[model samples]
Target: MNIDEDTSAWLGCPTPLEMYKHQCAMLEDELTTAYQLLKKARANIAGLVQMNDLLATEKAAAESQLRSVSADLSRVHVQGSEMSKQIMSLKIIASQNEHLHIENQRLLLELSVLRGPRS
Candidate 1:
């Protein structure tokens, strides 16, 4: 139909051109908001990535420390075992010394008896 006829038919409604412009403005605002949100999301993602990298580095450091501690513990265990073995040897020697002391004391008593009563 004619433009005037279409305009007349719209009767109190906004004209098509005005409606289109308003819709375009609304769409532009929505696009701007979406772009801002996207930018914020990218920033958040970058921060998370950096945090993850830091955590990974910390984990590696902790693991290295754990390995070092494990090595130290292993050395301590070996030293403790050696100490235990030395203690056992010492105990055996002490027992032998006690027996030798008792035998020597008995021999001295026998020698005194063999000499008869003192003058």
Candidate 2:
């Protein structure tokens, strides 16, 4: 081949092979990093799944406790209602007793007046 000036100049030009090798090495590191990241992500997802199951169990327990509380409240309300009725009945009985007492006192006074010495 004849050593043309243009050919010599082009042959002396620097190719980017070194840069490409560096980039390939960087890409390999990045791929390993990504794989590690994926592994961590999978572990986190598994933990999240376990946490979700635990939360579901806790929710069921809380629901059961709420039902028990509601039943207790209902029972207490019924007992309160019965107590209120009993109080009203007692008040009525007390009023009747007061009226009877007043009548008995008035009768006693009338009897005493009639028994006054006949002058």
Candidate 3:
């Protein structure tokens, strides 16, 4: 209430109202800094999500291509087996024909011997 009392109060310590105002200003600055950090963190999370989606798409495409290549290899194996079986069948037929020709030649020689000195 007196000038001397006011001067003594200011010199010794701050009033309660003045301390409260200072604390409020400090808290406002801290809140602004926290908000800026949170915004940057959210942007980083969004970029990571997009990168994960792209990797998943590439993985699916690679799996599909692998399956297609496996199917083609299986088809080639089946065709090769069929060709081997045909080749074996042809070999058996050729052996049987050679035996028949040899038998025919022996029979013709016997017939000429039985006829004796033919004119």
Candidate No. with top lDDT: 1
If ranked by TM-score, best first, what sequence of candidates would result?
Answer: 2, 1, 3
lDDT of 3 by residue, 12-72 (tens): 7878898999999999999999999999999999999999999999999999999999999
Better of 1 and 2 by lDDT: 1
**For candidate 1, which ten residues in a row score worst on lDDT?**
1-10
TM value for model 1: 0.66
lDDT of 2 by residue, 1-119 (tens): 76554553366754578668888999999999999999999999999999999999999999999999999999999999999999999999999999999999999899989899667
Better of 1 and 3 by TM-score: 1
Model 2 root mean square deviation, Cα atoms: 4.7
Q: What lDDT, from 0 to 1, does candidate 1 have?
A: 0.95
Q: Quick one: best TM-score, which candidate?
A: 2
Each prediction's TM-score versus the true structure: 0.66, 0.74, 0.52
Model 3 misplaced stretches (Cα beyond 4 Å) = 1-11, 76-119
Full ranking by lDDT: 1, 2, 3
Clashing pairs in 1: none
Model 1: CA > 4 A from native: 1-12, 99-119
Summarize candidate 1's per-residue lDDT along 1-119 as a digit string, tens digits: 55545554456887789899999999999999999999999999999999999999999999999999999999999999999999999999999999999999999999999998899
lDDT of 2 at 25: 95
For candidate 2, the per-residue lDDT at 100 reads: 100
